[model samples]
Target chain A: MPLSEFDIIARYFAQATPGRDDVVLGIGDDAAVIDPPAGQQLAVVIDTLVAGVHFPLETDPYDIGWKALAVNLSDLAAMGAEPAWLTLALTLEQSDEQWLAGFSRGLSELAGQYGLQLVGGDTTRGSLTVTVQVAGYLPPGQALTRQGAAPGEEIWVSGTLGDAALGLRLVQGGLEAGDSAAEQLCGRLNRPQPRLSLGIALRGMASSCIDISDGLLADLGHVCAAADCGAALQYADLPLSSAARDLIAADSGLGDLPLIGGDDYELCFTAPADRHTDIQVLAGQLDCPLTRIGRIEVEPGIRCLEQDGSPRSVTGQGYRHFNESS
Target chain B: MPLSEFDIIARYFAQATPGRDDVVLGIGDDAAVIDPPAGQQLAVVIDTLVAGVHFPLETDPYDIGWKALAVNLSDLAAMGAEPAWLTLALTLEQSDEQWLAGFSRGLSELAGQYGLQLVGGDTTRGSLTVTVQVAGYLPPGQALTRQGAAPGEEIWVSGTLGDAALGLRLVQGGLEAGDSAAEQLCGRLNRPQPRLSLGIALRGMASSCIDISDGLLADLGHVCAAADCGAALQYADLPLSSAARDLIAADSGLGDLPLIGGDDYELCFTAPADRHTDIQVLAGQLDCPLTRIGRIEVEPGIRCLEQDGSPRSVTGQGYRHFNESS
Candidate 1:
């Protein structure tokens, strides 16, 4: 017998959301009710991933599920908020029980990692698409926004960049990577991590922050625009995984891969020059590398500088949805 | 110039959401920040409407936008929550300016009517799909759930049933409707009014409540299942618009239309018999009709009764997403 919508939700989606006191109701209701902590502002974000557009058509179901929630959690991480609840609107071509079980398990693992409870959403028949809306809480006036960067502030990024983009290229047969490196980079591409703890640590210290979903240059451009300032990034300072560096070494023409490639899900932020030491200590505390790559400037446009401080020419700023074909 | 994703959002989606004190942050952020009213639990719901699945492939962009948000708000209304904020994840095959403008206008009108502020969302390239997640607030312990009905309680529905279903049929050429009536029913089908006020009023008064999205019998069956009881609906008491009556009068086989028809977006609720007059007064105040069509029974399944006190045969249950083909 084919699994009905209710049967699918019950057999696959519904599970014990133990020890969540703030959740008054979870799944199996018209809406989920939650009592958000008092005096804390709720941070809400929704993101949609479509097959063959947001991801490749042949991607594994588990990886697809993980990436879907990971991207939304990245948004909350950028805001320096603590994730609490999530709702998923999943549209599928059909109900494949084995695929659903893997997808749900992937989603459940991430939900457990973040202490996020699956609340309520809809499941319908359609071309494969997954939409996730996540909610988090932050103390009043404590959120990190894109508008706080100022001239003379130092730009910093957590972890490495360009690996996911390189992974994508390798997977698409545009580049060749060694077996072990390819696996690592593909992991980065398929399962980008959300820097939740790093974001929380940077809440009071960092002046501005954003997740790098649209590559380093383009996302940093957003911060620059929101802050009404310009930025100068040292090309050599971009953090890159060994695999990404090897790819660029093999082809110098791919120098702009890290700058223009997206889907890294790493946090790019700005902090006052005086907080550099504090950031170093915090990075050690979080066991994550924090690299200084750029600085905000009074000039009104973003520029990338070469070894001699000469401007580098780039064709694309980032991945533009309208310009790209699925 | 072609519309980039950001340009489309700025031109069509970014509008002033004024005087919303609870909304700490609106659009143009990683996520929206809101300070939900104190002491109130947040009720959240998400629904996805896919092109060609939820509506005809050629549905007007404006109507598509309206119905997407309307269905989500209807879920919130069923929970007796005051609408607060919404985020839309819109997927489109391509960025069409005229279509986007009309869709935004439709979404904006409904949002304004319900005081729902557009927060943050994502725009992606895909087959047309709109997923909206809405949040509302209700006093703790005051929400109406599907599990509260008891035997001897009365089943009531707000507004006429089957109009939208009829409208769909007329538009699909399944049946013909008169010009004026066709327009009215089509309007009902495309622009459903979420009973926000009625839901709020029934918060503490009603024993159980659910929005009739899947048809009267189907949704009431949900109430029955949740409350662990059965329902006896009087076939003669089913409310139908004049157009629906005319269609049934022409073909008695269409008599089951009202019972099995979906997309009404009306509230099907159960309340104690003593509160019947109160509900009537409330309906009068809201300028919407409240029809008592059935009573809760101790039996374990639903049964439809004819005017002559005999059981009526029902050929269809309701709209099941898995069972139906687009």
Candidate 2:
């Protein structure tokens, strides 16, 4: 027997509702109301994760909850928005108490960790899918976007990239690494840390910003295209986790995975040449390693440099969900 | 086969993009940023319509689109918020052009009618479900809620009650009615008119307001429970189409439908006893009917009465989608 909609909401989502002053109404009413600071604009992002397409059919519900909300928060982080409120629309294949409890516990814990509030949402019976809509706030004129880079600006990124994508391969049993590296990568894929506070701090300083979701190179292409510029990247300067590099070297088939695989969720940003030292100082306090790996140039094409100072193409097709189907 | 995320967005929802300054960033980016007026608070609402639950599998996609957005807008209306922006997350079974075109046409037409701008959303491959999140701005301290009604206030509603429920029965072949009422009721059920403008006009006037998504008696219970007051309703005073009354007299099953069915989307509110004349005047200008059906009472329980002064109770068991599956 299936659970009723009211029971599903009362048991799962309402149980996870965060205690917050801004949420005047939560869960039960026709809608939810949140009062943000008077001077701030609401930064909203929505994303959906489907069962077979977005994750393995057997992925744990707790991780799914974390990933769904974390990914949306990552988008807000790219915009330099402070986490605020969220609404979830869940379509479940079935109602299992254990699954609901685990998923909500994971989601509520993360929401409390990020200082975010779950305001309202809807639940329906269908194939398993989760859609989370998040609303954050940024003071007027402070959001970082993809259209502000200029010639002579330096491009930088925080943390290593592609660990999440590598983790997916390992989960599918298509690849293997040493126990420690494999566990670390799989954890990265399962639970991503969104850079909210770091984003707020980088608001006025970063010239341009984009989250490395689709892949580092493909995502940077978006920023460059929007800013009407080109870029030159140094392969030696790329931030690759020691574990990822070792795993890739262990299997030649994993070559270039760091450049083309998706789901890194790190902030890649550009800054004016003069502000590099200030950003470096700021990055130290952020606890995330910041690496200046590229430069925005006046030209209109991307060029990668090998360790030998020879030009190279940093292109391997990025992960495309549609391509697999079509 | 799977679809690319970008292709999915472009094919279904990209056309509704509002391309304006208020929308600092739109669909192509990770999140959307909307600039709200300085002194106003944002009122947000989200609702989902599943294929088998909310609508019949063979129901027209155009009406589905209209209802999904309309219901969200109706939530804003209940709070006396001015509809401004909307984000949609559509989980589709497949990309059907004819269905999409009709759905888009219906959605765009209704959006244009209300001057709403579509800002951002996500499209994914999954079971057919439509979720719309709508946001509006309310003047500081003026938004109406169900928690404001006081004892001795008069209860009022805009437009006829239970027409949508009647229409649903007729549509599903559960009940038959006169041709005019059948057409009107079915239209009401399919295309609910969100009283946004009227709701805005009532902001400071209506002590408590709720959109009649649930039936009159049960929705009124929300106001009663929230405001800590009881209500007395006069059933003979209910505003109903002559066709509906005729149908009720002809069919025994139609007797309980009005009190129990849902999806009316009309505005139910309470105001000072003296405001009935003013409400009627405003109704004239709005070209909608305002019916005085009940009064808030000092006691803390519900009571209903017939024209013959017989005591009655309202059994408002509104349609529950999740309950159907259970």
Question: Lowest-scoring 10 consecutive residues by lDDT in candidate 1 chain B?
Answer: B12-21
What's each prediction's TM-score?
A: 0.98, 0.91
The fnat of each candidate, in order, is 0.78, 0.67
Label model 1 with its docking quality class: medium
Q: Chain B TM-score for each model?
A: 0.97, 0.94
Model 2: chain A TM-score against the true structure: 0.96
Q: DockQ of all candidates, in order?
A: 0.67, 0.52
TM-score of 2: 0.91
Relative to the true interface, what fraction of contacts does candidate 1 keep? 0.78
Query: On residues A121-229, what C-alpha lDDT tens digit does candidate 1 reach at each position?
Result: 7999999999999999999999999989999999999999888888898888888978999999999999888999998898899999999999988999999999899
Name the candidate that leads on lDDT.
1
For residues B1-326, what per-residue lDDT tens digits would candidate 2 score against the true structure?
54565766677667764455567666777678888777777788888888877778887888999999999999899989988888888777777768877787778778878777777887777788888899888877787888888988999999888788888878889888778888898889889989988899898889999998868777888889888889998888888877788888787567666666788899899999888888989999889898898899988876778888897655547665456554
Task: Give all candidates' CA lDDT scores.
Answer: 0.90, 0.82
Instruction: Give, for candidate 2 chain B, the lowest lDDT window spanning 10 residues.
Output: B313-322
Per residue, candidate 2 scores C-alpha lDDT tens digits across A128-233 of: 8888999988888888988899989999998897798899999999887889999899888888898887788898899888888878888888899988999998
